[model samples]
Target chain A: MENRNQITAKQLGVFVLSAQVGLGVVGLPSDLVKEVGHDGWISILSAGILSTVITVIVIALLRRYSNQSIFEINRHLYGKIPGQIINFLLILYLGFLMVIGFRYFTEFIKLFTLKATPELFLALLIIAPTAYLSWYGLKPVARFSGIIFVILFFFLLLNLLTLKKIRVSFLMPVGAADLAALGQSIIPALLAFVGLELTVFLYPYITDKRNVLKWVIIANLCTSAFITIIFLVTMGYFGENLLKMQVAPLFNLARYYRAPYFGRVDLFFILLWFPLLESTFRSYFFTTYDCMRRYFSFKDQKLAYGLYAALTILLSRLPKDFTQATQLGKVVNLAGIAVFGFLSLCYLYSFFNKRGVKAPCGKS
Target chain B: MSTGMVSCVTIVVSTVTLIASLSLPPWGLGLPARILKFTALFFAALFGILGLIVTASVTFAHLVTLESLGQPYFQPLIPFKPGKYDRKKRP
Candidate 1:
């Protein structure tokens, strides 16, 4: 029932932007600080560039196949049995991502604002809305991403307010982290841009195909710029050592600055960040459901959604606490690395696979 | 800040954006529709101030009711618009 071809390339830009800037960002600056000290921003920029180039390659592969998603393309190149196995792996990885993302947001909220609330209760609050959005399908999710784009501007403005206490010297010795550390941090830094993988499944649905490359690259650059500014601002305010010690450094930066008319700006930012989280959930769930719909041939999409949500909740509960949840997240991040590597191989196969042998993947 | 202060800021920003986006020229607007728009924006801002989840839910719900270029707000999801689907396939 999805009118997949109705989404404009510009909307695709917004969707990618939202996906790239979700829950991982909540802890990213601090994590980067720990790895590369004052040079964390360098790693962030490198990761952004790496993600952008990877996205371009994925888009190139999609262009060769016209209307088929990466899922169907895998089927074309690898045949049914192997293709379905790849999709099964992809689906499980996405499920792990959703559960990890859900746990991360809940832990952050429980730690900062809702200390008395049960973590499961907070997790349910997010799951309810994300389930509703995912049940509706991709266009609603895309439009929701566009709206989140606007809210991000407000978030930026709030972040800029921290400039009141910016110390220029704190960002000193910009490339202080050695080359080995900077290189090592790139993999972890990529956690922020994992959403770029959505481009693989989403490319065929783009309405204005000519603008696809343009908008997607632009979205990549936009996220990089935003992440860069946040890194610079937080580090300039708190410096690398202080930032490393703080959990959720960006939130803490916002928390320290207060205006006469506003109370706890960080809490306000967290509240508005809910939709971005939902968009993240929707992106992963939609991909998981698409895998099911494609391989299992589930004509009933809602049935797939129900099964996906149930699985996500059950897996999400397996991590008994935040520490275990983070460990699970690291494993999911490893899966992300594998998935992208597999996609690159799939792209290579698609180039050699003849056009005449390509199966019809249906309407875009 | 007190709840009243947050509500006041929310109302102002929401009202300003609503007025700017309204297609009806300020000189010719119906009072009831105008009031409805204001109320809707106010609650949206309030929901935003309350938490991220509520703000997102409210925004998504509002967007679903809208249309642009004769297409539904969620055209890709809904797909019921006439002639909107009549475009030739890309070669």
Candidate 2:
């Protein structure tokens, strides 16, 4: 049966876009510059291509089952014990993503805008609304993604003012990073695109299911294009060596950018970031809440959302400092890689079983 | 005020404003969404300004008990009233 709250393909694309952007895009240029110079954009593009291929494999695996969520497919393909264990692992990953994403936002705000603000207070200021919004369910969240996509355009506009500072010579040594360096940057770049796994859960709730792959790939390309522009601009403005020292190259673009009768563009960009950050928070929490609901067979969704939000906020306090928070982020991305590996294995088994049986596939 | 006092005030004021903002839409009252949007924005701005002043408050445990029109306003932001407000009565 089709879900009444199903989102359209376009909205799904926006959801994927919002999920991937998060706070990672702000620091992406600096992080990549340390390794690949201007060729960092290439690393991001390669990661996008990799994500698309993995997404296709995930979609193929999903198509083998009849509209069942990944959590359900886990139980059906494996025994109940292993299935629950896998589901719990996926839940843990989503929980970790939520906590880390929150930490990143709080840190960014504290560093740039509110240097003396308490971490717990800032975390609540962001998480409270995000959890409240998640309570409204996927349809509202999908609708909110439309707003987030529009807000992202404001970042591009603010970024354009940095043109005055750009130097063509900075990008003259384009391939300076070499193939090996570019290859090394791919895994770190993949961390920025970790949320693509959202599709495995979102597919069943998407309208126009036939075009899911097309929309998702478009979303990936759009995100890559956006991040690439930021990378290009940052490299041209600061050069690779200077860019490496900056924490958030994209936000820094706004620090120097000036327009007619206006300044402090960085603060403006940060203000607009609430919706974008909240959208990412909601998407991860959706997976977390959905997993909890399925695991416990909980009928009261409000209670489930509350528990998820509380646990997420609790976990956010565990990281000792910014370095530990980032290390935890790397660990979570590694766990995400394992989850994708598991998905690929599921697909391989399905494909071989289909060939062997010669029976009509995708039935429950 | 001291740092701790500022945070305490920030959380208390923002919490009250958040409840008001969450509840003002009056989905039960059948108010137009535009008005609800404006009202919510007003409260949200108030909440944001107050929260910005403190920026370092504690957790959000108080929101759990907040309600709107006799309904839990924090989570499950929408109530499950089937066939009451919609053509299709699926909760």
Candidate 3:
């Protein structure tokens, strides 16, 4: 097969939005309220700012390798053997992420819907569709991602409407509610924004790679702000104490209805997330596939499927109990991947001058 | 893909997958899959089997169960306390 590298700008934006929505909307908010009290939104905003800065830094590095994906850039900058090693490290990092992402969705389902079922089932339930989409390729997956992005934002809007129910008194005295706890909370909050790295490997698919920075920074900002507000509204409507007490506060907040037409918030949140989950997993599979293909020369997509299945199954099992899983999951926060050496690679690749064909500063 | 080609692939793939999905125990499919996924992305065959297992398990477990299940059934809920809503209200 010819080297297949083609992605539209719309697809890139959708990919960005999918990465943002997948993990953050469901879990990022709880810690914010738990740690900072009413000012949890502030931490979210801080985390968002940090995410954007990091995202921009990484994008600039990727742009420096304008014509190359993260895998190709590494291969160029480091050469075959060492580059393959870097690629393996990044793939492992993302593979771990793919498992965790699968676990996150499964855990959410188990917590809210199938309390009696084995999580392996729920984990598998999710990965099935994800597998099909990954096999289908990224463009189709991303188009669906764009559609879900709109719906996710709408859920946020609906969630905000519920905010009128919150007592202003519940939101007062916002500053430094618990400085130490809030400081610690930022780590996890930052982790929720983990998918930004997806953009790093996606440069090759992107049609108008030149416009990547503009959409990328914008999507990151808007997505962060939207989620930050959603977190705040969920907290404001339910109060920090109550919000932190629940699994998905935003869902419960949307469910807290008195209108004659609807009875629950979770059903809507669940329906909306169905597609978001697909796109999220698709990107994870695609990026990992690209990295592995370039590094290990693992060309068989079936093998990729098998690896993903095992990772999720094992990850889903590790939480020997639900509490342990959530704790371990929380421990694997936004900055977690960076800690695993992605950040080091970014600096090294950029510093070593693996600049793309027409890089940002023309300084490859 | 042509309907004929698609149908042929689906039947061929599903037959093998049906066997794999049924034969493998929970968490048992890990080792082989790990080596495969470690090197590249997924093949439709393995993904199909996983899809079947997840769907069958979820539907069968629920249809057979006396009560609804929640997230990662074996894991403890956060805070390790059952919520007030875990039980339906008397009202």
TM-scores for all candidates: the values are 0.81, 0.79, 0.72
DockQ of each: 0.18, 0.06, 0.05
Interface RMSD of each: 4.6, 7.8, 14.3
Q: Please give the CA lDDT of all the candidate structures.
A: 0.74, 0.72, 0.63
| Model 2, runs deviating above 4 Å | A1-4, A353-364, B1-91
* Candidate 2 local lDDT, A112-150, one digit each (tens): 776776878777777766665566566656655666655
Cα shift from native, residue A82, model 2 (Å): 1.7
lDDT sort, best first:
1, 2, 3
Candidate 1 DockQ category? incorrect
Worst 10 residues of 2 chain A by lDDT: A351-360
Worst 10 residues of 1 chain A by lDDT: A355-364
Q: Over 4 Å off in model 3, which ranges?
A: A1-5, A76-79, A178-183, A303-311, A334-345, A352-364, B1-91
Q: Per-residue alpha-carbon lDDT of model 1 for B49-77, expressed as tens digits?
A: 33445544754655664568755767654
Residue B88 displacement (Å), model 3: 57
Give the RMSD in angstroms, all C-alphas superposed, for model 3: 16.0
Candidate achieving the largest TM-score:
1
